[model samples]
Target: MTADEVFDDIVDDLAGRGVSAGKMFGARAIMLDGKAICCLKRAEFGVKLGAGSAAHEKALALPEAVLFDPAGKGRPFKDWVALPASQSEHWPTLAQAAVQAAH
Candidate 1:
């Protein structure tokens, strides 16, 4: 599925679980209690799973997965993972982890 479609599915699934759709750094994002849990940027699904956490490590192990760097600078968000379309299947699971971490 396309990134948009994947994002839609995540939003729908999380919405019922109390997550809201919002914007983060101008990108479409899933929010929990007003904090961004994940976002879609350039077809990449960026999720905040906390640095060094099990979820973060697993996500980084995925092909093409990387630390999120919105500005394209070397300074990346340690707690965020940027998952490419190839890793879309894992988005939901990681997104759930993000929500839990946020709580």
Candidate 2:
């Protein structure tokens, strides 16, 4: 799905779970009791997320997690880890990680 779709689905999903949802970086950010959990980011190069510093370290431990494409032009938004398009099932995993990072 597209970034906007990602944002919309995520927001609806999280909110359905009683999480707070809002906009960030022209995409969507999710929060649990006001603490961030994840976001769907729209970039010129591709759809991605900038899961903060703490999330970066934790996500590294997951088998499915990966740093965004090395050559990707998202250097300006450091600490971002890109999930491949094929890893659709991992969105929840990634969203959780993003929330972990923000918290």
Candidate 3:
């Protein structure tokens, strides 16, 4: 699926979760309350899990996940993870974790 399609699927999955869609960093983002749980940055999705949290550590351990470092080789958002397109199947679960973390 295309990036837009993937993002749509994610938003659809979160339909009853009380999250909302809005613009963030010039991209589409899923928000909980006023905080961003995840955001679509180009073709990739960035999930927030809070720095040093167990969920953050676990996500980082996944082979398909990486630290969300949009600024290239610089200080990365240690809590956020860039979910791999190859691992789209895991997005729902990761997205849930991000939502919970955002709360």
Candidate 4:
């Protein structure tokens, strides 16, 4: 999928689950009770959790969040990190971290 499609899918997932969300820097940003959960970039199909957001760390611990190389650097974080394709179900946890960083 294109980066934009990936980003939109994430935002759609969150919104589908009833999480408040928005957009910034052309990235899909989730908002929770007036807070942001994460920032998703369409070009890179990347999701950058807000500063101090623990979603990335938490996701790292799960097997679902495999480190993918999008930049051909063999580095997971260089270009983009693969979030669980099942992120829709993981929205609560992810969004919580986003809210934390947003606040």
Cα deviation at 65, candidate 1, in Å, is 0.9
> Could you tell me the lDDT of residue 93 within candidate 1?
92
lDDT of each: 0.90, 0.52, 0.81, 0.50
Question: Regarding lDDT, does 3 or 4 come out ahead?
Answer: 3
Clashing pairs in 2: 37-98, 37-99, 55-101, 68-82
Writing each residue's lDDT as its tens digit, candidate 1 over 4-82 gives 9999998998887789999998899998888888999988899999999898998899999999987777988999999
- Choose the strongest candidate by TM-score: 1
Give candidate 4's error at residue 84 in angstroms.
3.5
Query: What digit string (tens of lDDT, one per residue) describes model 4 on residues 3-102?
Result: 4455566566567455665764554666666544455542332344532335666655665554434444666552223564455445445544543444
Residues 1-103, model 3: lDDT tens digits: 8766777887888868888888777788988887778888867788999989998998888887888876557777888998767767777788889878876
Model 3's alpha-carbon lDDT is 0.81
Among residues 3 or more apart in sequence or in different chains, the pairs in candidate 4 whose N, CA or C atoms overlap within 3 Å are 21-31, 37-98
All candidates: CA RMSD (Å): 0.9, 5.5, 1.6, 6.3
The C-alpha local distance difference test score for the whole of candidate 1 amounts to 0.90
lDDT of 2 by residue, 41-89 (tens): 5431122344455546655445555564444464533565555445555
User: In what order do the candidates fall by lDDT, top score first?
Assistant: 1, 3, 2, 4
Model 1 per-residue lDDT at 95:
91
Query: How does candidate 1 fare on TM-score?
Result: 0.94
